[model samples]
Target: MTAVALLLTALFLAPTGALAADKIVIGVPTSLNFLEGKEANNSVKLAVDEINKAGGVKVGGKMLPFVVESIDIRDAAPGVPVPEALLGIEKLILEKKPNALVVGPFRSEALLAGMDMLAKHKVPLLGTIAMSPKTEAKVASDPKYKYVFRVSLDAKYFVGYIAGVMGFLGKEFGFNKVFIMNQDVAWARATAGIMTKIFEGKLKWKVVGHETFPTGASDFAPALMKAKMAGAQVIMPVFDMPQSGILVKQWKAMKVPALMAGFISPLTGPGAWKTFDGKIGGALNAIFELGNIPSAKYPPSKKYYDAYQAKYGVPLEAGHGPAPSYASVYLLKAAIEKAGSLDPDAIVAALKATDAQGVMGHIKFSKGNQLIYGNDPQKEALGCFFQWTDDGKRLIVYPPAIAEGTIKLPAGMKAAK
Candidate 1:
């Protein structure tokens, strides 16, 4: 053969498509019995499975299937040390060597600790459920944090809705006094702080009582009695802990008259009524998403909800956790396709320019590399305050445009005339 023919052959074979397909691995280090983690795991699996079924994703002229690797970061909350979470992530990295992680540790404590390892290994992650402002603040200002991206609502994004709901309840019910029950964590504290400011300074409501409890406390009777005696019209508990289940159950059993709202994770799921054995009647919760309600302005939102129900035979537990987890996988794919390579730096750059629409809406990252929401009512995310009906359905009562029903007071309580 001629020398020129041999050179041409070499050039044709040089395309990356001729090489082995790239494997995109997802690592989820969630705690045991935490429904949010399981929801995220299943949601991610659904997205990955769908992509694989459709001939996988094409990158650099080659189709590559996604690979998922999950681990249990036991006791993964603020009470646990940061090093323990770091160890769990390190294990996943050593075992899987993931190209990218769509979901990571569930809370800010673990996320903050796991960032350094992710950066060192050059693994790009799109976090789904960690809601601390520090996660974005650090990534935005520090070059060391370039690899970490948050696709879910953070502290600032969620606080706006919570405060808005508090203001609405005040005006709607003529409730003039409020009490705050906050768990001692960064996300809860930040939410409580903003709510206090909005309820006191802007809404002109009296601050009746402020209570702080450690996570995992089963008894809320003392705090409940204190708020009731202080004449608080609203009781805002700002925490995502499982013990929050105890607070809601106790409130009903003890017959606390004040309205319970804000950061109510335990009450967000469909089975919550049965969990407490019908003890959570008339309880208000700030739910970021719901399948039945027109919570998401985006049309694809309903499609996601239907798919999830068909696959799992149950409603999504916490919409923020699973919805964002499923969306993050697609977002990562979009970024990789735009970049045309699996290189982390290129993917990060493409993510910065992301404006793709997902189940949540048209998702775009802010300067801090955090997903932005709630700025536009017609287009972006809008959280609802839902109260449980007597028949066990969550009825949206805030932001009248999409509300399923009006807010009804608990059987014994009356709104001011």
Candidate 2:
């Protein structure tokens, strides 16, 4: 074949630019090695597929499909050095050259380290897993970091939701004494500390005890027993690891009289009903601003929830990760279409002006704050406080406006003795 003919053939087959199957690339630089990172990435992919099927995004008067360029960064797995993830971010930004980045880094350390990199390249990032409020503070203080947006649960939001539930329990059941137990991690510790302040200062409740345990630790007996002995009427457990399954089992086997509430990761989703063998019944769990269980409660969340379930044959991870990551993809599409161009600065401006409904509810990013707006579903992505019913259903039990069930004494609890 002639050289000119071969070159023309290659150009026709290539799926870039405005020729054949053109696409807008979204960079997902995260720890792909673990569940949270993996699921979050999957959610991003799911959104991409949905958008592509819906005729993609219109840009430059042509519809372009969305695609993802995800880097392992060792999958943002825990204990991985921030520098390692930072290098992956650089590679993804410079090499992959995505139009926008979602699910940027799994670790807060990595997120903080990569901020300058995202800004240097002017690639907007929607971080869906880093919980550090410092990220928000950084965005608020510096103009250089304005390209970053946080869709993850800030510690304040998690602790605030748990505390809000505790407040509800206090008024509903005449409960007062509270205890705090946290899995030894920066996010958990920070949240627990905030819980202490809120429990003591605002609620005027007695904090009978405070404890911390390392991640992957088994046998929460010591902490559970301590609460029982301290006359703790309620115990708030701050955990995100899988081993929290052990904590739930111990809470039931020991028959502790106190109501177990807080962000017990294992008990937050529908699977927990079986994973804990119904022991999680009546336990209060915090499902980050995204809706709980089926991940399809709210119309927006339901869309992704159904897509994921249909594609992967499972429900969404009701954790701090996937929901927002999924929503961020749609948010990116909205911003891109709103900007009517692929320019980074224009997209960031449109993102700041977002008022679309997302997984939990309406999503509106704060101008400089860079966090999702408000604590109510009407104004923002309100986190849900849910209880697992004995019949194996998750019922919203807080935020009276959305409450599907009232606060009831946890099923596994014994009468205060």
Candidate 3:
């Protein structure tokens, strides 16, 4: 009788034991474009490690461990031939079949490719970068692609920021006419189009000039000269990191006097500032600097910053792309645990129901597939306007409350005489 009882017990426990051994795999597709994506990938890995140390995710009366599998799609060398990174992402998705996907530090084109695979699989692809509204439109237009969502503010938000800054400058500083230069990418074009409508239609500011440049074009001398000749008070250049830095440096060299400001990648960091120190004109950023603040109203920034610096031995910067990526892991874990199951549908439901406090703020999803804080609609996702100090520190100048100090205009950015 005892032997028979023990055999029954082992049989009953076998499936649950195997389930305990099972791990939830999360896929992260870092962009091949810049270092921000790499940092985001690292942050996601760190969060996964921390969760595992805390005994993994608890669901369905079982504790299942989780692992983050990162795919480095960044181009490493000058010109080594290899499979296109987007195709590699498709292969990873098909092969590993992770439960969820977190993509990018701004690669709208690449993300557009990966979204096709994710939609086919019906897996959730939460984006930390690639904020084009067109990407949102793709999901909204198709009921079948409901699994796609973004935590970051859309491109329109960037346009709003630009318009707000321009309005402030025009009203306060008597800066009127403006020139807009944007990269030829989908995001840049979309953002620039919106800005033109706002400046021309709403503010009544004259659009002295507008131009589009190829994404990797090195020289901005010709474009800058045109804006200068047009007597524009502001020049808004929307492009990626390295190129944006190069553009600013070249603009200064050409002695372009326009107040230069636009969307810049957080990845530009201190290194980029070091190159264009005291040269970059008025600048506004979507991300707030974590290290500079003593205690943010949001709690997770400090905690995450401390843990990250302790582990990585470097002060976390606004451009450190991994901060939000790391937070995504925790956010997903909370959703899965709340749902009490590993089923993708259940997880998705819980994620949509998410009103949990996150590093940024209380992240809640709306029917429009937008993530915003429940506490404040205006304070949805973190963004700020910052300009470089003489000492190369990024000082928050807008929104008043979080200002490190007032914005110090660079030498050549004075009101047009």
Candidate 4:
């Protein structure tokens, strides 16, 4: 192994039990059982190492390096209660007293409840997951919640992007009828609802059926059958859990004719086709970071894509975990430097004024303490809608300016008549 690789491996694998002097502890309180959790931790560690090597953030006349301290909130998988996640974050904060946080609770319920603790403790956090619109409301309504920021796109923004793609499909294949399937969770349901309103109101598409499935529920046949029976042309599924694997496998096996699109965390990466045993073909996934499905229209995506592969020895996966969490770290660093101290409120102010290029593209915080997104890769942090081919290839087919190919249906499936 090269010297750089050895050094990175040491830092990544290093124990967080002890803290060195003049180091800023970046706490990661997320569910370790999920892919997003693991990737979030990995990406945060990678970014901290990169920043430390480059003469760490200067604050209060001292160079403060970054160290990662994480706790397993265990909410991404089923069975963990929201209260338990609340306690986990509380413990991570009281014990570690990290200068800042990243990749917080994986579920919206925990995030809503955890927001109180974060505000009470006055620890600034940059969350990459848990996209509930309520999060924005909380930040907007209360000044105490100003310490919290979502680096990843929220559900509303996600729905906006998906709605446009669905509209394009309506024009492309004459699709009209739609089916909405979402995990019984706040984030998924919100995304599904927002898309439904847009489809029915602005897009003039017919809504065939809308169903909510329990989290961790593996049987998707019932919904697929209903969608087919309703003569739906598009299947919009919002799932953040790993059950997406089951959903796609069932979709392919059952030969569902509708175009599957929306947010499926499991199918967000370049390796998704292989991950689901090549069953995800023809499914269009809405990614949180453009890098999740890497496009040539953006150079930063390529840089982050290659660096992740080199550091982790695998393609980046686990929803929008890696890239967003990686970017969040640099954001926190920049905020700290801009504030020139470890004061939480000052960091929050710096973050609000942030306008830096991330792993995807340009990033700036608009209203609601969320990153702004636009169609132009050169302008804002942009994401795309991509479809998978049968032989495991990802095609960037949306936002015409950055599109590499047109959306295609799975072989043997015909477009809506």
Candidate 5:
């Protein structure tokens, strides 16, 4: 063929500009049926929409929009086989070829499975939930696994905040003795151990009855009876099971009213109050965020909460849910802009140097890639402890510096029938 004919052929074979829309694809691999999944997905949507409206992230003088593609991992239970859980992330990476991945597996086991795959692929992962300390420890243990970073508070930080609240409960409510109850899972186990140390050693609160139940244990009556028998002034539950509603209901049915707080995942959402038919009232619990809480140092939090309620018609669930996921997107955008490139290594470095404010407060990365927010008593994320009032509203009651209300023990606690 003549040179002119060859040139024409080359022109035709070159990549078409028609398919070239500057956009970054983020892959989310999680279980949509679960709370974390729904919250993270929606939060990411909110952030992406906001960023896109504001002209997206600037890369090499070109603004690139972001699109999130999700892979449903189905129920994120710790009992699910690791191989099966890993497959979701594998499928997402292989099918979507996203610029980064936001990992929000509700179970620690699922996060563990996804971690290895993320490290192998060298894709930067920003984990929002999955608070197992083991995840960050693994990353710290191996330099090759630096690609994984947790944007949410881990178990240690969470337990620390819980301990702080327990101390407050002891001082304010005159609760000298407490009972410990938790699930057998890793996160709960770690929380129980930490609380044990804090109560028994540091704070000098007596730990009376300690019980561990399986994730789906339906009967907490025996445990409540034992706690009351032991004269526990407070009953703390460290759990992650959806069936925690059973425990709460049993607590009320048994009328064992030691001021309750710890592993409050089940009570964080507004829907939970109705789900349990308002039985959560008078229950003191630790929550990571609330629409009007003072720990939400970020000015946009109330706006985010209002917008979420307006959009979903329910209060925003606090914890490692919507807030962190929403903030993670903004954090990623900041990192990408700081890096000025889409390369994984560059983005990872930028993430390490992250220092931005979002709905979750001023997000900054510390040692082990842990995201620190607000004025935590510890150097990690700020923790908020709240109590559900008789009026069906949650009031912040701990960390006196930021508390919006005082501790209110259950009505029948003194009688302890």
Candidate 6:
């Protein structure tokens, strides 16, 4: 009788012990595509470090240490015949059986390449920079893709933000005709499509000119001259930082009359600011303004900025890439605690149920695994417009509540006569 009782007790506790032993692994497949990738990966590292320092993730009444296994796959060489990095990632997933995955600073093409593997494994992927709708389309059609998610907002949200900024410009400053110049990348093309739809369909604004440039083109003089010739009052250029900086310099040299505005990226950082000086303005989804950090409302922002500067020796840029990486880890932690288990399904449920405040404001997931935050007053993607001061300082101009200072049009691009 005594032996029977002891055996039963041991069996009852065995499953609990096994459950407690499960460790939650998070795979980080970060891009080395450019300097932006480096910045984003550093932020991810910082977030993981903070979480580990806090004793890792808790699951089933036991604490399981979180591990971040990073894969660096940068396309630096031409025709070097690199192996498919996603296959290696798949192998890691099968062996480690991670609870979630953090993907990309990689190009859309690279991310598209990995979608099949991720779907096959049923692992959730939160991307930092892959923002094309096609990526979302893949998840929507795949029954196995219930696990994939992205921290970055889609093209629809981006267009909505642009519309809001344009509305503000029209109502407040009497600006009308606009020109849009977009790179031939998936993201840029999608953004241009959305902008055209909103301006033509909803706002009834005239698109004076529309132009597309090949990605990585050295000079933008021809495009700028064409926009000027078309009588465009606002020049909205959608390109990455390096090329955008070159465009700004060339536009200045060519003496284009249109004022510049566009989405913010690594190009709007201090490095780009130093080069472009007084020639940038647009809606910024992320802005690292010092005055915006009021301790009363956002204590964590101050702490994060201070710690980031202390560790990195430079101020953090206002880009979704870095902030989402940090927020995703914390979000994962919250989900784990809520689920009380390391099961992926349970964690996913917890994540969907989240209404927690994160560094990038409130992060809540909808039924389709889409992030539902950042909707503006027009029920669109919420973003604030900002302009570079003549002295070259970035300032929040729209949304009076968060404005650090008033919006000032560039010298040559003042409201149309």
| lDDT accuracy of residue 196 in candidate 1 | 81
C-alpha RMSD of each candidate structure in angstroms: 3.9, 4.8, 4.8, 8.3, 4.2, 4.6
lDDT of 6 by residue, 255-330 (tens): 6777677763545555556655545433232332221222223355457656666789986664556666666778
Candidate 6 Cα deviation (angstroms), residue 131: 1.1
In candidate 2, what are the lDDT values of residues 49-107, reduced to their tens digit?
A: 98999999988778999989999887346567888778888898888778888877767
Collision pairs in model 6: none
Instruction: Write candidate 3's Cα lDDT for 193-291 as tens digits.
Output: 988898889998999999998867778888889999999888887776356667777776787777776766632355555556556544545452232
Candidate ranking under lDDT, highest first, comes to 4, 2, 1, 5, 3, 6
Candidate 2, residue 269: how far the Cα is off, in Å: 2.5
Q: Which stretches of candidate 2 lie over 4 Å from their true place?
A: 1-21, 292-297, 373-375, 411-417
Runs in model 1 lying further than 4 Å from the true structure: 1-19, 75-80, 184-186, 253-255, 288-298, 375-378
TM-scores of all models? 0.87, 0.90, 0.81, 0.87, 0.87, 0.82
Stretches > 4 Å off in candidate 6: 1-23, 75-85, 95-97, 108-116, 134-143, 253-255, 264-266, 276-302, 375-383, 399-401
Candidate with best TM-score:
2
lDDT of each: 0.77, 0.78, 0.67, 0.83, 0.75, 0.64
* TM-score of candidate 4 against the unseen true structure: 0.87
Per-residue lDDT of candidate 1, residues 124-214 (tens digit): 8888777788988998899878888887777676777777777777678888888899998766776788878877788888889999888
Which candidate do you rate higher for TM-score, 2 or 4? 2
Estimate, for each residue in 274-348, the C-alpha lDDT of model 5 and write its tens digit. Answer: 888888778877766433232443346667777776777766664556677777788889888898788788889
lDDT of 2: 0.78
Candidate 3 vs 4: which has more lDDT: 4
lDDT of 4 by residue, 1-417 (tens): 999999889888864322244778899999876787888788888889889999898887789789899999898767889999889888989998888899998888889988888988989889988877788888988888998898887776777788889889988988999999999976677678878888889999999999998878988999899998998888888887777668888988888888888878878876677667888888888777777657787777878777778888998775576788889999998888888778778889999999878886789986678888777766788778888877788888888868999888866668776
Off by over 4 Å in 4: 1-21, 216-226, 241-243, 253-255, 412-417
